[model samples]
Target chain A: MAQSSYGTENNNFGPGVAYSQLDAALLVYQEAGGRVSATEPTLDLSIHGADGRVLTGGLVADAVSGATPNGAVPSTVSQNFVTPLKARGSTASVTGASGGSTIIHLPPTPGQLATAALGRQYTVAPNTLPVDKGFRDHRGAITLGWSQPLGAISDVGFGGGFSRETDYQAISANAHIAQNLNSANTTVSLAVNSEFDSSSPFGGIPTPLTVMNAQWKTQASRNKSQLGFVLGVTQILSRRWLTQLNYSFDRQSGYQNDPYRVISVVDPSSGQPTSTLYESRPDNRQSQSVFWDNKLDLDPFVTDLALRYYKDSWGISSKTAELSERINFGTAFYLEPNARWYQQSAANFFHYYLVGGQPNPAFASSDTRLGSFTALTYGAKLGFALNGRSEVYVKGEYYQQTGNGHPADAIGQLRQQNLFAGTKAAMVFLGYSWDFH
Target chain B: MRRPLLIILMAGASISIAGCTAIGPKPWEKDLMARHEMLVDAYPLLIAADEHIYFSKEASSGGRGFAGGGCGCN
Candidate 1:
């Protein structure tokens, strides 16, 4: 998701003084085994007015490159796959090890010998996961927000954002309102958000469940629309504790399938892939979740705890818990250590591979994201205060995911293969924030 | 699921009512609450970045607030 300026319902900068703040950060993320790596740079600026009005703007750029799983299961024998050539007419001959795969030309069809070079093919070695190492993309996004105190309400805000990648574009907007009660000890807030996205894959939108082919698809692009809302409450439990709860609902419709992803159709008895079919997913999804968080101040140390439960119409449910503790070293620096645990059930239609002879399901996908899994994230943040209103911080985190690699109903050769595609990753973030009049 | 949710809601309501009636830091004793580190979202940008990464990797998202914008990362 693109970075957003929404959900700032509790950001009440008491009246009297006006100042502008600037925050800049750079993040580097890498998945284990050279799967995916991303570098992102973000900048945000906010100006506060004496009368409680605030204006904010932000910019973010991302560069991502590395191999990504192609939703295919490993097999005992080497496999070959083909997809539409990215470029139409470049004399780039079949390059060897072109992003971890050897590219080859396909034979001419019928009388189209002259245009036989319209597709690109690659070979994947046996007993190895199929991945598209050629994956690389760059994205840029901008967001703007304005908030101020209304007549009766404590605060009202509006935000909008736009993001663009090589083959994707997204536009989003949100509005929020907050009210303080009980001597400003209890706060209630609500936020509504909407987003529209268009996906124009390099090869076009393929027909779901159809055999994977190299020919370009006719459909140029597809679009999706999302609408969501959140209701939140924050209460000061005591002089040293603050707690918050939020409930959210979201609905999404339209193209929800990954155009480049395919599922293997295997021989029912041999457990060997016979062919691959484009993956499919339900066009509409509805989801709901509840989050609870608490913050406690203990003199020189502070503790934070959060819990969340989520459920979706696709037959997926999840639970999450995160805890963090910050230790202050006088007034100059602080260290925060955090840990998070998460678990989720798989989507109803998730599968490792489809049997060739059995009837096809209405919706099916092999995407590992839809599979059941558990993840753990452990990290720490170190921050140094350069002055009363300026600080520099560095955060490091490690994430690991695990899933059932061996299923009870595993077929032939698949019984010996590890179907789990979860990933391990490391992330580092460096940031600096300063205030100015 | 419904049972747990109901229990939580009731507990939260009870706590809120009790806290409102009994606790009083008065107005001047809010020094601790007024600190920047005490804010609910003190590290807004950092949290946003973390959420962005998780959104791309996980199947579920957006419980704390409205998740704005969309990306094709998943």
Candidate 2:
């Protein structure tokens, strides 16, 4: 068996602290049907995150104890456990989470558990103090698949998946076909994917917190859809080298906004409407990506490279290149180093804050931002093989984006080094896989 | 592929008639164009509108979702 854990705590000035968390998992596969063989399950097709930061005003000066603690209600903690079993006829599984715990011990209250049921809420305050308002939630997804081989050189597969959280729902349909050639040394595959999403807040805003949930209330009732097609070719040059090329075209034409955000600023010059009273931009994007992958086996060492090119509307076209190499000293032991590069062009209408530039009627948005951006990413993966088919893998990465030739007006004064840290979101993933004979 | 090709040709024709199209990169611009990250997006105006719409309607927010208001308290 294998296990891992990762989490982060952020201290905001106005809102209470926030935390992002993820835990470990173990998966076991058993041979059944026509063949009794070990299997490697594909990663779950659907992923979800619903954590939010809390907003507790500030510290309450406890004169008696000399501890400047916030007189706030305690926070509740919830944990989710997910397990999936991939079988031959189709992929099958089970998943769920556990909640209803009062995690805070201090700042006691009569009804602490009920009060912490929701995430934190922020108030309209400036230079405010901080408090403890972190939260954790859960969601799970499952998919079923079927495949059939045509003769000895080709096979087709079809699958469907569904996922749901407290306030959102998602469903997907997928199909693919793989072909073998060159004496079974070369393989080509093509796939099509489609998904639909419906989301809501489940009446998340309290009457007092109406202002906080205004934009969220609108996004709660929206429709989102995505379609993607991929063509892949894999070639084996001799027994020690494997190379692959994949081209994917993804078309997404739906409500592509966060639904829960709004611009509430006034034009500094005249103090007029800087924000158009819930007037945010919509998006219909088309992204074409080409990726090349190679894996070389060198007995104790393995090397892999992945490169991708992506372009979309909104003026944000990008390229990403990545490299990874692994060295396995012995059984149950391995080390790998990886690095990546990414760059992009800002959205066409991206502006910083509204400057006193001449009025151009074509540009309807007063919110000037989303110019251009470039980023550099780097990270590493450390993995070890477990006894039998069970093993664990852990990975972490960092990304930093700066300006390209043209900085969009939407970026505000963030071109400075001071705000670069906020523009970054680091991720760590841990996973385990095994088979039962 | 055939339908998509027809649409592209039609769009190119309309753009030419309107006299409002960008002068595509010349032969010399291929070096820059061939760079992995360089390409044109046909519909950013629509994308911006979509992003604004989604930002107003979702529970979890991020991506390009930060509106002009630094105070997302709203």
Candidate 3:
């Protein structure tokens, strides 16, 4: 049987044979309506020692580009927005076509003869979503882990990872321990993880709830820290049934706002945007969740079911359920079909837009992710066993989200607009795994 | 919040009771349980990737395991 330990799965091989497995996969994701697209390639290698020791390493790279919403409501009239240029003092001339936007020299601050900086401006057509067409970034990440059996304990492991992007960096570390009991039918595990992140956007951090402007702000960067733990239990319910339960707790502190996101301040009666302000969120957050999963073997097929409940200090609550069934065809191939349902309530401070005359809340965001919504995902995987030690698989999934587009409290033209036109996305993955001695 | 906590406690208690019933499989009868498809985390990497995508797009994350890494995507 597979050892129920972190980073030690699929280690049941013949005695005295040292083996290593390599996994490579490519993921392609695209959102409908040209919002965002990403391609990621990942490679992982794990080496298993003869004496129950394992070392694993992985590398991943992502390229993302495309338009992304700026958290502004659709408007009847075209709107123009401006942001600081990529570089501070570059003399490069403005281009007519720059990612569907234009770069223009900003007028000098009063009493100056020359312009101080360049700003990029994008225009949104009437009744269209305001998106930043220059949204693009590349990221690379690496992870390393090691695990080994320690005397009476099933496994103990510690791992660390680092990922870097154009504007962000993250460093994380984790440790876990597992114990087997009841004649190896039950396994209990505990894992703790910590992460530190630095966000240094190209244009500097903006003051929360301040007017969105082309002028650069003084705050250069911000950092966030997170700590979390998970406790899990795995049990062999029967010869053909296995079950697992997990409870997790997480806490975060420091900057939590998306520096680039904004919220529209609209006229109270007409629902027309009068100004835009940077979004804001609480600096500290705490969350907890429970997950239960089961796998049942039924001769030619296997069934997997999982359920999760999550709650957070931000007044956001969520539930998720997923099911998958794998059908085996002889010994060389298998097909798995899966579906997932998820729903989440809005954060207490989520608003489609702030009213111009109302007092600003201490914490507010127009990001749809903080709003109530339901999502469905359907997918299937096809796997081909090339040999006893190698396999190839391809999977595709479709995801759709829906929410109340028009609230009863919506004012004037806002009632006619789809405030929550949720997202639709498609993803595909191709993967290969090989084990060698 | 209280209701969900109550449900979680009840579920945990039920599972604990089931574990104490001694209805688990014997070591000799673990062949079926040993199959790859029967493992609790049959596709760890795929699940990890899925979780990453969800973390970027959703408001809630991390129940099946500790969230190992942080990103500024949200």
Query: Where does candidate 1 chain B have its weakest 10-residue lDDT segment?
Result: B1-10
DockQ, per model, reads 0.57, 0.03, 0.63
Best model per TM-score: 3
**Residue A193 of candidate 3: its Cα lDDT?**
95
Ranking by TM-score: 3, 1, 2
TM-score of chain A of 2: 0.60
The DockQ value obtained for model 3 is: 0.63
Docking class of 2: incorrect
* lDDT tens digits by residue: candidate 2, A189-274: 78888877665433322221012221112123555677877776665543455556666666666554332322223344442222
Local distance difference test scores for all models: 0.85, 0.39, 0.85
Q: List the residue pairs that clash in candidate 3.
A: none
**Ranking by DockQ, best first?**
3, 1, 2
The alpha-carbon lDDT assigned to residue B54 of candidate 1 equals 80
Stretches of model 2 off by over 4 angstroms after superposition: A1-137, A201-220, A264-279, A354-371, A403-422, B1-74
lDDT tens digits, residues A1-437, model 1? 11113443233334556878899999999999889999999999999999889999999999999988888888999988887775543336654456755545655555323455556666788998888777889999999999999998999999999999998999999999999888888887889999999999877888999988776666879999999998888888778898888878899999989888999998888889999999999999888888999989997899999999988889999999999999999877999999999999999999999998899999999888899999999999999987666789999999999999888898998888788888899999999998766
Worst 10 residues of 3 chain A by lDDT: A1-10
